[model samples]
Target chain A: MIEFLNSIQNSLIYKNFFLVLSGLDNTILLLLISLPVGFVLALLFALGRVSKIALLSRTIASYIFVIRGTPLLVQIYLIYFGLGSVKFIRESFLWYALKEPFWCGVIALTINTVAYGAEIFRGGIQSIEKSQVESGLSLGFGKFLLLRKIILPIALRKVLPSYGNELILMVKATSLVSLTTYMEMTGIARKIMAKTFAPVEAFIAAGILYLFLNFLMVQFVKYLEWKYNPHLRLNN
Target chain B: MFKFDKLVFGDAGWGDEFLIATLMTLLVSILSMGLGLFLAIITVWAKLIQNKITRFIANFYTTVIRGVPELLVIYLIFFGGNAVVMSIAKVFGYNKYIELNALTIATIAIAVISATYSSEVLRASYLTISKGQIEAARALGMNKFSIFFKVISPQVIRHALPGIGNVWQITLKDTSLISVTGLVEIMRQSRISSNVEHSPLTFLITAAILYLCLTTISSRVFKTLELNYSKGFST
Candidate 1:
């Protein structure tokens, strides 16, 4: 049984298991670091979109437009190889972080997801009934305070489900970092495939990892939905 | 700060290459999107079918395709496809390399991903249809094929337009990943131009702008289609 299990074709998984698992560290790091930063930025953008200032809202809207319109891959290349090549940026203090391919990827992923998440948040914010805002206004709450206290709480909760999809998207998107030579899951998988000459099996392993990650994210979203909105919960 | 010296037409510039690449991106995206919509309908049908195996396959297809990254999907189709072709040729005793075209592989990859997403949209739109409509169709003695053509499809289009529009935008942007397979799309064109001009930022910015134009215009078309399809439906 052991001999049968140790066949040449079957050795692919056990052989490079640790090498591939190391890649997950980068992938998880990308997800962990970028997501919080993206959430804050997405919220700010969403607020700016709803703000009364025409110039501010318009600027934020265009920023979101540009981000959404471009491919995440192109955005990564623009930041890593494109912006990273600039003389001024290279000379600046920002070069410390920009010099790393992984950081470039995080920057791209954060910006891309912020555009998408901001849209989802904007939809959530806009869906808030006028009566709620008017009540806050009538209660003498300042605009910023109301937004910080009430609007954000409700809007963020309302959009949690939609935002969950964005989370899964970001998780999958971390795979693109591999293109920048970041040793994420996809990158490691690619190397293994080349060495083993078994592209399908390599992809299957990576694909399974991604699916597992996304499945966890989906469950996380469901838990959030259940936790945050208790009324929607089913009681035994 | 960004140079446009390499953007102008003639021997001095890559303006022609950029134009051709943009067209290629559009062509590939359109081809994949059309095929994806067809596949999505089939997937939706499979999911809706009562057969256990068909439903499981359809569900698995959507779930796995959605869960995995586009890069992986593209790589698998590109390399695995070549491997399959080579193995088949070996089986035929030819003993030679047989590779699939990059364009075909890229299109298939994007088509597959888009189909899963669009299938959900299509399925949701179909399910939104009230049970009464189908019951009425049956009462009218219409067969299954006739019922779908005469009843379900028109309503599905009306409800599915906005979602389909979103899928189109995603599909259009996904064509950018095909550049990795050397499909000569906008992203690859920018890479080549940037290398030649030694100004990656300018060419990339130009590429971003072209994509912006495509996205904005297609969105407008979809908005119009949504309006047209929704006509006579009570808001």
Candidate 2:
């Protein structure tokens, strides 16, 4: 056992151990950039889906359908390689952001999650009772005020569980960013494996990190659920 | 002249290659879904019987498969599966290298991942079968097999159609991961085309359209099935 421990400690694979420890920076950066952009896009898409205008609703529906139909990896490839191939993108001012694998991955993941979250939010909005809107209007609330005070809050609460699931899925989906050469946990692990010839150990360590992150996400979602639904609170 | 004509039918065109890859993708997905359905039936049966050990095993399978990301599962199978297979083959006195096809391994990986979702859908449908109906069928001297086929199967299919449709979609999307195994699926073909042609946008967009075509058609068919099934029920 001591020999085994010593072997592991001395191996080049230990670089991956260090890489995994430092990989939290990439993961947090990905989440911070993608989440808010995804949320805003989701909201707009949701509103488009629920819009009274036929063209608006159809356009958003088609966008959601196409995004949901294709795999996230394909979207990433398209954004990273496909978009990057265009001379315009390369020559334009946006090239600085587009050139980076991290931003490319963020753009792809954000767009993909927005498609899913929009559908969930649309469902939540549609499920809201007509009586709630009636009450808001009866109270002389303006359209924006009514939506802010009544519609948006209720819809948000209703979609929170599905949104939580989407967030966790986004976390898992971020692993695909490694394919774009963004040195996230999986990328670092793959690099370590290539150098150290320890595929199993590198992947196992990366898997554990993912599992831990997912567990944290689940706990956070549960807390949010409880916090939002305080009326269900009973004697502890 | 050769360049322009070759652009239409050449190795670089990927026109033929893309079609073949799409066919392979469909083949793998269909085979995996079939395997998943067969496994799901047995799992649903075990769960339905309420045996303690069986229940524990079934629950464990679902938890692990669903809790972990599909990519990890695929990676585990891709990297470790061959070694296990070769060892078993060795015990049988096989002298030659026992080669496992990438398509077969991909099918197995996808089927295993899909079976978790399929089993849950089947289990839920199994439960939705009215207890009284089963008891009545038994009281009427119907055997277990007869009860299962004549009474349970149709209802379960009808009720589970939408959920099963979802499983089909999940399986279809999951086929993209098989590209990592070096299988010439649409994604892989597109990637190759992108690298060779240096026109990643064109090929990627084509691949996306192919996916959209497959999914849109299947979704429409499933919607039709849903409508047909719901026709008997009143509003």
State in Å the error of residue A101, model 1: 0.6
For model 2, report the TM-score of its A chain. Answer: 0.92
Model 1 per-residue lDDT tens digits across residues A1-236: 77787685466665555667778878999989899999999998898898899999999899889999989988999899887888899999989999999899999999999999889999999999899989999999998899888898899899998899999989989998898998899999999988888888888788888888899999999988888887777793
Interface RMSD of each: 0.9, 3.0
lDDT of 2 by residue, B1-235 (tens): 0123223455657778878989998999999999999889988877878699998898778766766667767876777677778889889988677778899899999999999999989888888888999999999999989998999998998889999998999899889988988999999998887788778888888888889888989999999999998886837
Candidate 1: lDDT over CA atoms? 0.90
Q: Which 10-residue span in candidate 1 chain A carries the lowest summed lDDT? A: A8-17
Question: Residue by residue across B1-235, what tens digits does model 1's lDDT show?
Answer: 5888878887888888888999999999998998899999999999998999999999999999999999999899988888777888888898876777888888888999899989999999999999999999999999999999989999999999999999999999999989888989999999988888788889999999999999999999998888888888848
Model 1 has a clash total of 0
Q: Each model: TM-score of chain B?
A: 0.93, 0.91
> How high is the lDDT of residue B57 in model 2?
90
In model 1, residue pairs whose N, Cα or C atoms come closer than 3 Å (at least 3 residues apart or on different chains), thus clashing, are none
| Model 2 docking tier (incorrect/acceptable/medium/high) | acceptable
